[model samples]
Target chain A: MHLAVDISLRQGGFTLNASIDCWSSALGVFGPSGSGKSTLIRVIAGLAKPDSGYLELDGDVLFDSENRIWVPPHLRGIGVVFQDARLFPHWSTEKNLRAGMTLETTGMFSFEHIVKLLELQPLLKRSVNDLSGGEKQRVALGRALLAHPRLLLMDEPVSGLDAKLKEQILPFLARVHRELHLPCILVSHDLPDILRLTDRLVLVRDGMVCGQNTLEGLVTQRGAFDMMRRSGLMSFVSLEVDGEPVRAGVRPDEIMLANRPVEGLSARYRKPGVIVRLIDHGPTILCLIDTDEERLMADITPDAVRELGLKEGSPVWCFFKAGAVHSFD
Target chain B: MKSISPAEWTALLLSAKVAFGAVAAVTLPGVLLGWLLARKNFYGKVLVESLVYAPLVMPPVVTGYLLLVLCGRNGPVGGWLGRTFGWQLIFTWQGAALASAVMALPLMVRSVRLAVELVDRRLEEAASVLGYSPWRIFLNITLPLARSGIFAGLLLAFARSLGEFGATITFAGNIQGVTQTLPLAIYSALQMPGGEAAAARLSVLSLLLSLMALGFSEWLARRAKTGRSTHAPCR
Candidate 1:
């Protein structure tokens, strides 16, 4: 599906100027907490109208300032899962899940099928008031799907959840898209949220679309890398294990940088490699090493890297204790 | 004094009927206006708010005078009704009920509006996205969520209607077994010689009715304050 949106919206003190022309089933809008990411989702769902521009989804004009055409939210056929899971208090879990169902909406997203897909049988009769945060979001997703909307808009669906609850909900979200093939826009601040679902990223910062490209493509650019890194206070990271029966994990900060291989040290697992990239994060810096076997990321102080004269393409040795690398099945 | 004179019973029954009719008459308008005041941001909203409060703030006698001029026998509205439908509101129980309803409207609207405002607009937005229209959203979501406040308002209005005097006397006129509700009955009894005992007994009856309605209204209001606000699913 092709969605072309060129709009300018001002809400109170914040003004958002965003434009996107993309053809992707699942899209991710990545930004910080106050970066107007959710506002973009709201505008797409027809919840908020932009000041001047047009939004054409699949060649259908949802909004057009020049022609004076604007579709109301109910007629937009775009379902949204709110961050708070705004379930009806008077409704039971079953009622909430079936809120969007009607005579015409039966086949592609059926009530019985959704109940089974979300494992909502045990929760159907229960009051929405009694459901957990994760359960509420699941019911919300089911409710949105049962409406048979043409597009789905999710605003921080799992960002509010704790790690364990987030883990529990993310797989369900992934399955919903994989099985149903519903075109969706997932808006979130965290990288994992975008990576788990779609590679197409629209990086929003301070109410502007700073970059729109694939994850690898955007990160290679200097400005996109700095904005994304500072937004979440997390280093751009990826993991790959090569040539071993064991799966090992180690904190990037623990992998200290050294000029040469130390013959006798308390730490184990010394590997010499060339620094491919160095991302500065204020006090500490991240060094991407391309080892003989694989590429590994290590975190070290700027002083350490500066003292070792380590720049891009400079050969370096990385050290970490054997106890630091935890093995997982 | 020892027994409620057949006349006193007439007065009690008439008052209950008038109060019930008053409550029924105001329920629809009360809810509609209340929801409007709470939800809609429009031009001249303050004018509407003042109009709703007029009956409560202005002397009931002046309001009755206005109603009498509008709906009196030769008055335009009353003449139209009399000519078209052969209906008469002047010096009738229906006029008494109408007067009572007007007097009770502010209380009902106040409660309904407060409760409606407490309902989360986010939920209604969610409903709209789910394809429910504005009317369906109000009926299914807003009204039900605000049920407790509406009930409390109904009781308060009922209590207010039971004690209506100035408007009913001015427009409906106090007549024995017809427009003479509790307060009017007590007043009528006191105007006669050696009627102190009858007046005292009927006054006590009026007091009991008011206390009961007030107690119920207070109970509902307390429950409304303490129960079912935002159920944090996250908890």
Candidate 2:
């Protein structure tokens, strides 16, 4: 299913002109904060009115400013999972999920299945406040799924979670995309979430969509690499090496005392990078590697630096597994 | 000579009757107004809110005088009612009830309005997506969720009606068995020569009734908070 949206809005001095046309089952809108990501999602969900726009989902006109056709959120058939779970504090988890379904819902996912999938049975009777951040988000996802929306709009659903918690939620997101056969538009600033959940990426900058393409295509693009390099969201382009792929990523904490280049199947891409700066970061030493246009941060133990005789002007080969280099754009 | 007088008992019953009558008359409208003020954003909303709350902060005597001008016999509305339906309100128990209702209207509105404002609109939207109509949403979601505030408003209105003195006396007058409410009877007892003990008794009853209403309101509010479920509360 394809969803098309073209909208423009101006609030105070900030003007947002954004448009997205995607055919993928899972699309990611990647942007920094205040990049109009929420506003764009709101417009798509029919929660916020755009000054002028046309939104069509699967050839059905949801909003056309010219025709004055503005369907409210309920009629639009789009389920939204806000950053905060936004669960009803007055209803049970089961009821919250049930409330999303209509009497006419046929062939939709069952409430029981969702409860089991989200592991929400234990939380069904508990108050919303009693649930943890991760559990609340899981319930929120279930609530949206029970609605059987044509398109799911999730705004930074896992941005608040730590790395491990985010990883735990990622599989559920992938399951929704795969098992449900539903198209989704997820908005986030985290590259890892986009990498884990979506194949298509839409890069938004200054409230305007600057790029939209496949993750692989975006990864190879100069602008994408430049943005990540500047923003501290590191990306290393992976190319096919032998039958598998040679991948690379920055594990800033992994650089250690290496007198010589280590050889093994684990080192996916070993490139000689120049150490441009060295600084003390508490107990460890932070080595700044200048790899062409991108600067990589490596956290090396201070003892490793002294043993390796590494300084600002030394040449060291950065080594990491190909798996660490995420295929996401 | 020391026993509770029949007239005093009648006055006590009449106070309760007027209070209940006034509460019944204003409840649905009070809730509607409360919801409207809490949720709707329209031109002149502030003006409408100011008008609804005017009786709360305005002098009770002035409000009673306004009621006299509006609903008194031979006045515009009173004249129309009397002419059209032969329904007279001046110096009647119904008239006293109407005066008490006016005095308590803002209290009812203010409490319920606060409750309505606290309801989460997202849940209401979620209900709409589930095919519930706006009215159904209000009944199933908004009203139940704001039950505490609404109950508080109801108690405040009931208590205000029970104690209403100035407007009740001015609009309906103090006939012992008809319009002499608790506050009015207390006033009468205080004014009568050597009626100190009777006045004291009436004051104690009024205090007890007010305290009871307040206690019930607090209990209902606490119950609502504790009973709130984990699911979406508003819708």
The two-chain DockQ for each candidate, comma-separated, is 0.32, 0.30
**Interface RMSD after interface superposition, model 2:** 3.4
Number of the top TM-score candidate: 1
Q: What lDDT does candidate 1 reach at residue B175? A: 94
lDDT of 2 by residue, B1-235 (tens): 3676787778778888898889987798899999998888899998988888888888888888888899888789999999999999988889888988888888888888888888888778656655456787898888988888888788888988998988888788888888999899989888989889898877777787778778877887777776665224443
lDDT of 1 by residue, B126-193 (tens): 99899888898898788988888899889988999999999999999999888999999988889999
- Candidate 2 TM-score, true structure as reference: 0.81
For each candidate, give its TM-score against the true structure.
0.83, 0.81
How much is A283 displaced in model 1, in angstroms?
Answer: 14
The TM-score of the first chain in every model comes to 0.76, 0.73
Show model 1 residue runs off by greater than 4 Å: A231-329, B211-235
User: Cα lDDT of all candidates, in order?
Assistant: 0.85, 0.78
Docking class of 1: acceptable
Scoring model 2 with DockQ, what do you get?
0.30
How high is the lDDT of residue A147 in model 1?
97
